[model samples]
Target: MTTYFTKDHEYLRVEGDTATVGITDYAQSQLGDVVFVELPAVGQSFKQGAEAAVVESVKAASDVYAPVSGEVVAVNDKLPDNPATINEDPEGAGWFMKIRLADKGELDKLMDEAAYKAMVG
Candidate 1:
């Protein structure tokens, strides 16, 4: 799997044509104790950079944007009831959605781990 990151701090773990999407560890840290996540429905489509989910935390609510355009294939059902998982494992079990990519070329616009780290730094 190839992982790509957005400037907004979202991540896409791509495997073939599908990708798992989530907020980054840095983003969850910034949010400070996630309390809720409003996820996209399966089969729903989104454009690159569009609002795909909403994450609410003790600090504030933030939009989790679609790092690349795609149709939602799955969503993490565990998030609403166990939102703190976002803080504990933001990039693993804390993933928000899986999407069938609309265009793989869109990934070229994103950052790799190194570029992302430097940008965030």
Candidate 2:
């Protein structure tokens, strides 16, 4: 799997033609304790960098942007019931959705881990 990141702090783990998407560790830390998650519907389409979901924390609400254009295939329903899962496992069980890549070329526009870290800093 290859992981791509966005300036907005979202991460995308691509495997084959599908990509699993979620917020990064830095994002969860900045948001403090997550309290709610408004996930995009399965089958919804979005452009690269589009705000596809919303995350609400005890401190504030933030947008979860799409790292690459794609159609949402699935969502993590567990988040709405217990949003803190994001903080517990930002890159694992907390993944928000899976999307079918609309254009593989868009992946080139995203950052690698090191670049994303620098962007976050």
Candidate 3:
């Protein structure tokens, strides 16, 4: 599995044709404690770079974008009740959604772990 990241601080773990997406650990730290999460509805379609979900924290509201174009197949409903889950595990249990890639080529636009690290640093 290869994990791709975006400049906006989103992370994507691709496994076969599906990808799990979420905000990065750095993002949660910068946002402070998350308070509410607006998840995309299942079946919703988004283009790469399109804003799909909204994460509201004690500090600010951040848009979670689509790192690759796809249809939202599932969401972490646990977030609505306990948004802090993101801060606790931004890359694991904190995953926001699963998307069925609209076009595999879209993944090319995202950054690799190394590039993402440099971007955050």
Candidate 4:
């Protein structure tokens, strides 16, 4: 799987034509304790850079943008009841949704691990 990141701090773990979407650990840390997450419904389509989800924490409520155009295939149902999972494992189980990619080429616009690290640092 190849992982890509947006300047907004979203990450996409791509495998085949699908990608798992979530906030990076860096993002979660900045958000403080997560209080709520509003995810898009499955089958919902989003254009690249469009708001696909909402994440609210003790500090602020932030919009999670779609890194590339795609349709939501699934969402993490466990978040509403246990938002702390985002603080504990932001990139793993804390993932917000899965998307079926519309154009693989769109990923080329995002940052790789090295570039993202330097940017955030």
lDDT of 4: 0.95
Write down the lDDT of every candidate, Cα atoms only.
0.94, 0.91, 0.92, 0.95
Per lDDT, the best of the predicted structures is: 4
What's the TM-score of each model vs. the native?
0.98, 0.95, 0.97, 0.98
- Tens digits of lDDT, candidate 3, 1-121: 9999988999999999999999999999999999999999999999998999999998788888888999999999888898889999999999999999989988898899999999888
lDDT (tens digit, per residue) of candidate 2 on 1-121: 9999987888999999999999999988989999999999999999987889999999888888888888999999888998899999999999999999999999998899999988877
Candidate 1 segments exceeding 4 Å error? none
lDDT of 4 by residue, 42-113 (tens): 999999999999999988899999989999999999987899999999999999999999999999999999
Q: By summed lDDT, which 10 consecutive residues of candidate 1 come out lowest?
A: 59-68
RMSD vs true structure, all candidates? 0.6, 1.0, 0.8, 0.6
Steric collisions counted per model: 0, 0, 0, 0
For candidate 2, the clash count comes to: 0
Superposition error at 31 for model 4 (Å):
0.7
Give Cα distance to truth, residue 69, candidate 2, Å: 1.1
Q: How accurate locally is residue 39 in candidate 3, as Cα lDDT from 0 to 100?
A: 94
What is candidate 1's TM-score against the reference?
Answer: 0.98
Q: Please give the lDDT score at residue 55 for candidate 1.
A: 96
Which tens-of-lDDT digit does each residue in 1-121 have in candidate 1? Answer: 9999999999999999999999999999889999989999999999987899999998799998988888999999989899999999999999999999999999999999999999878
Candidate 1: which pairs clash?
Answer: none
